[model samples]
Target: MAEKLPALAFGELTDVVRFLMEIDKLKSIQRRTKVLGTDRQENTAEHSWHFAVAVMALAPYAGDQVDIFKVLKMAVIHDIVEIDAGDVLVYDLVARQAIHSEEEAAAIRLFGMLPDAQGKEFHHLWHEYEAGESAEAQFALMIDRLMPVLMNLHNQGQSWVENGIRLEQVLSRNAFIADVYPALWDHLKNHLDKAHQSGWLK
Candidate 1:
């Protein structure tokens, strides 16, 4: 037999439910990377879920001991702001900088929908990811940046080709991955070399 769980107070339940409903909007926010083996673009919600899974899978490769739970939380909440700011290409320096304020505003507004304690936790996790200072944040950020590259690799550099992205650009943008996980960076660079030689990248 299972133990019965305590129920939440009515107000708390309402706030939690409203926050859940609000974050559902994240699914509608499309990203530049297409889903593997599909023509359709992935959504922010899908990316978050995938990121969390990748975090779990890649946790062993992290350079230092990390709180897997904290990293997973960071992955899940990091992009909820995209529900308002929309997805920007990782390679787009100008557009990425332009939306910094909008993304921060979106983060505050969306996370503010939750009750205070829960909201603060979400905000902290999101900001930690943005800062990328801690070991967990670095691991999480590495995976976050790696996923689209993986997607592009599997899909024959679809986004890179479409965006006219050069091999140098991809390397420059994602070189920080080496600081977190050099082995992963080496493996990725090898594939990227093949990709460039195959003429998938400009």
Candidate 2:
């Protein structure tokens, strides 16, 4: 049986605690990317943390004009909506389009778990990232694409192979990197070429 608990206090912090507990749901949201060299796939919680770290580590590579803080914020919250919508691979064209409404609904419910002020802020940040209209969002999107590409390459194109994703699809999904961070795009293209030459890509 589960352990019995003591009485709890209900106060100003209750909403905050509730919000945090609700987000624990993110851990169960599995992503398409795997931990390199492992057969197992990653969950959204791990993806968010790793992406936040990557934002910090790669911020220097982003243009001098971008805000690192905003970029980091985008990385961590971009997939929080996936807790409901689940993950849809970028190459899955139809599902990607279908999930937009699902994700928006999810974002409304998930972020609304918090107090109004915080929830509004969370939703705004998520919307900004999704829009990719600002420099921070653009950089965040680049790293988001680049990280999975790196994972796929290191895993010998595991997901790419499983999904039968093609080189043109990858290039199209990742082309934005060339405009924002050419060096990062060059690095990603190198790995992609290696994957192609190794016959890891079909």
Candidate 3:
């Protein structure tokens, strides 16, 4: 017979479970970026998972002052607000500003579903990621920005072409990555040059 799992009392565990169930809605939140090697658009959940993994891999490059634990936490919770605000394109400056309040409201509601201390930690980490001021936050943001660029390059700039995004726009939006990770930015620029030459980016 299979081992039976123990039941939990209705308290902190229940709150955590409820929060987990609620965040499951993130899987249904679609993004404009397609999954590389396929035409299907990737969802926020997949993006978060991929981001967390990328953080683990790139933590060594984020400098000695950066906290990997905080970076990882920020990665996982950064997009939970999108469960309510939905995914906005990073390049959409106006749309991003317009949704700031909406995203904050969503963060409050979703993170509040947890027990007080846990909720506060998540909320703080989420805000830290958004602020992008701390070393850890900057590192997290760099990887966050890098992922889509890498995906677009691999997928032949599918989303960029479809959205009429220009090379200058992409470079301008992601230029901050150079400040955070110049080596990686240099590597990405090479691929971007090829993409531009191939007319994948206008």
Candidate 4:
């Protein structure tokens, strides 16, 4: 007779399936943007993918030795909490203040869906991204801050103009990234200053 595996055996395969399904929900959480014209509605999945690619593209500028894979995972899971908190505009001061509590609650609920070990692992990754302590997390954040700026610039400040966003607000929102990725920040600031001068930024 074949030996039994165990009374309370849990298959890692099942845990993977559950995590995949939960991650799939990211495809439905749309962001507030009108990029690429026709009022583009980007979902969380797209945003995550964009950041992951950007992290690699900008990796050399990271402050310390960074594991590209960790940065990718960080980017992919960083905003999963936004599914519950909802997408808040970068320039919205009131919404930004409430984001912490709302996202913490959402993180508990969303991450709680996974098997114990898996949930804890992902929660740690998400928290690391938020803390911006690791080199990977810092790089991940730079991309996160850069994406909207790229969108606005590419679309000739379409979203910025619509949202009544000023250059000062955009600069302030991304200022933290300068602490780790000063080169990227410098590049962005140059573009932003030109954009402001040319009436491309409001």
Error of 3 at 154 (Å): 0.5
Ten-residue stretch with the least lDDT total in model 1? 5-14
lDDT (10s digit) by residue, model 1, range 1-202? 9999874456648888878888999999988888888889889999999999998888777745889899999989999898889889888999999999999999899989888999898998888889899988888888999999998899999989999999999999999998888888999999999999999998
lDDT per residue (tens digit) for residues 25-94 in model 4: 7888888665376766888788888888887887766645878888888887888887788788878988
Winning model by lDDT: 3
| TM-score of each candidate structure, all chains considered together | 0.93, 0.93, 0.93, 0.85
Q: Model 3, range 174-200, lDDT digits (tens) per residue?
A: 889999988878888888888988888
Predicted candidate 2 versus true structure: per-residue lDDT over 1-202, tens digit per residue: 9999963556987877877777899999878778876878899889889899999998778878999998888888899898889999988989999999999999999889788998999999999999988998888998888888888877888889888888889998899999998877898888788888887776
lDDT, candidate 2, at 32: 78
CA shift of 11, model 3, Å: 3.6
Clashing pairs in 1: none
TM-score of model 4 relative to the true fold? 0.85
Which pairs of residues clash in candidate 2, taking residues 3 or more apart in a chain or in different chains? none
Q: Any residue pairs clashing in model 3, and if so which? A: none
